[model samples]
Target chain A: GQQVMQIPQYQHVQEGEDFTTYCNSSTTLSNIQWYKQRPGGHPVFLIQLVKSGEVKKQKRLTFQFGEAKKNSSLHITATQTTDVGTYFCAGRFYNFGNEKLTFGTGTRLTIIP
Target chain B: DVKVTQSSRYLVKRTGEKVFLECVQDMDHENMFWYRQDPGLGLRLIYFSYDVKMKEKGDIPEGYSVSREKKERFSLILESASTNQTSMYLCASSFPRTGNQNQPQHFGDGTRLSIL
Candidate 1:
């Protein structure tokens, strides 16, 4: 079975502070996707990382995939109140069927004004 | 933008009653999935369909079944509702990916189901 685990289950930061969440997978993954779920809302796709040791950025957020493709990280620079939500990392294994994705427990981010 | 709609935002049912959670996607995605979200469990896949009439079991499909009569519709069925089955159910749809690549999934708001 494949598992994706996230660190810092919950995080609280003041405006202008930085935050980061780590994700590790039990098995090697072909690719990994990041999603954000707002309070009382559904999960929304953020970004996807495919190549090993790849890094992508979306405005204030940066995503990195480990060289082994078994780990990933999301970093936010100068966090804002609007960044409050739970960030999840999902992985698709190399040989596993593509029908389903294994989602991480998620890191809940809260920002203080 | 992709939109996925769930039949209900909230539902209440009694034990031993059959329940169905309907999901529809405006985008003609080739893949659809059903998942349950709990406080610490995150999103656990229950079932998924790659094409109409084509289905597959996911990580937690013990108490669930799925239907995919059409490309845009996917349904999750609970044979007999139980208290332990109470959770937020989510439906998602995505375009099929090639090889080992993964596609982005669009999710509906989800159905909060309660079994008494």
Candidate 2:
């Protein structure tokens, strides 16, 4: 079974600071998706990356896929209070025939006011 | 906007009782999934269905079961609830788009179940 693990189980940053969370998979991934879950809310789709070493930007946030396709990272610039939540990375294993998404333990971010 | 609706936001059941958690997706997705979220374990998939009447066990499906009788509806059942089963249950749905194995799953608000 493939596993996806995330670094920094929790992070607290002052407002206007930066934040980054890394995700690594035990096996190669065909693609990876990022999701955000706010307090008392459902998980929301953020973005997905497929190409190796690819980088995508969403406003102040940047997402990167590792060259080996087994890792990914999400970085947020000038973090605000609204950016507080848990970020999760989910990936589909390259060789796994099943269409199940394996999610990381997640990185919970807190922005100080 | 995709709407994944869970039947309840909170539930309580006694031990040995049978519990049913219902999920409905309005996006006409082909795949549905059930996951349990815990403090340090994160989201662990319990079951998923790609088509009606077809089900597959996920990483942690030992004490759980699923039903997908209709495309828009999926259900998770705990045949005999236990104290360990007290956790947050989330339901999600996705469609297979071009090039992507499956679209990103849209999640429901989740049901926080407490088994006593």
Candidate 3:
């Protein structure tokens, strides 16, 4: 079974600060994706990284994949109130002739006004 | 735009009762997935279907079965609902990728199911 674990299960930061969450997988992944779920909302697709050591950015958010493809991270610059949500990292792996995707426990981000 | 519509927003059922959750996607995706979300458990995959009438068991498929008679529709069935089955169920659809690529999933609003 594939497992993905995230660090800092809950994070609270002051407005105008930075936030980062790390994700580690038990196995090497073919690709990794990031999703955001707001309060009382479903998870929405954010971004995906495929190549090892790949880094992608969307506006103020930066996503990075580790060189070994077994870990990833999401960094948010100057967090705002709108950034309050649970951020999840999902890793897709190629198992024994099958494709398996595992979702991390996620880091719940809260911003203080 | 892709739309994954779940049949319900909230549902309440008694223990030992059968439960059916319906989901439909308009994107004609090849992959449809059912996941359960808990406070700290994140999204646990219950079942996934890649094509019409083709289904596969996911990580947490026990106590759950899925039907995919059509490519655009996927249904999750609970043989006997229990208190532990109370969670937010999500439906997502995505295009099946070739080789080592992966497609981003589009999720529905999710149905918050409660078993009493």
Candidate 4:
């Protein structure tokens, strides 16, 4: 059984502050995907990391995949009110076809204006 | 943009009642999934369909069944609902086995089911 765990289940920060969330998996993963769910909205795909020790960025957000491919992190710089949401990391194993993703518990981010 | 649509945004059902949750994707994706989200428990996959008329049980599929008669539509069924089944149900779709690049899942708004 594979389990993905996230730390800091909830986070609150000022508008100009920074925030980060960590994700760890019990087993090695082939790839990991990040998603964001705004208040009263569905989970939206953000980015995916495949290669080990890979890092990707989109504007104010940065995502990193651990060298072992069993962990990942998401960092936000100068967080804004628009950044308030729940961030989730989902991992896929080596197997193909019909293999479902294991999702992290998620870190709920709240920004104070 | 990919669009995944769930029939209901909220639903209420009584114990022992049968429930049906409908999900439709406009992208004609080969993979469709049903999941339930609970606080502290994360998102648990209940079932997924990789092709029409084919379904596979996921991590937590005890009281759930799925149907995939059409490529664009997938349905989840609860034979007899219970209070413990109350949670936010989400539907997702993705392309399957395309290449090394993993396709991200597109999710619907989700349906909050309440059993009384």
| Chain B TM-score, candidates in order | 0.97, 0.96, 0.98, 0.97
Evaluated on chain B only, what is the TM-score of candidate 3?
0.98
Best by DockQ: 1
lDDT tens digits, residues A22-98, model 4? 99987788888999999999899999998999999999999999999999999999999999999999888776343
Error of 1 at B65 (Å): 0.7
Better of 1 and 2 by DockQ: 1
Judging by lDDT against the true structure, name the best candidate.
1
- The list of candidate 2 runs beyond 4 A from truth reads none
Tens-place lDDT digits, model 3, residues A1-112 = 7689999899999999999999998788888899999998889999989999999999999999999999999999999999999999998876732444789999999999
- Model 2, A1-113: lDDT tens digits are 77999998999999999999999986789899999999888789999898999999999999999999999999999999999999999898866545788899999999989
Q: Is candidate 1 or 2 superior in TM-score?
A: 1
Instruction: Look at candidate 3 and tell me the lDDT of residue A99.
Output: 43
10 residues in a row with least lDDT, candidate 4 chain B: B95-104
Candidate 4 TM-score over all chains jointly: 0.97
lDDT at residue A108 of model 1 (Cα atoms)? 95
TM-score of model 3's chain A, to 2 decimals? 0.95
C-alpha root-mean-square deviation, each candidate: 0.9, 1.0, 1.1, 1.2
Each candidate: fraction of true contacts kept? 0.80, 0.59, 0.68, 0.64
Is model 4 an incorrect, acceptable, medium or high docking prediction?
Answer: medium
DockQ metric for all predictions = 0.82, 0.67, 0.74, 0.69
Pairs in clash, predicted candidate 3: none
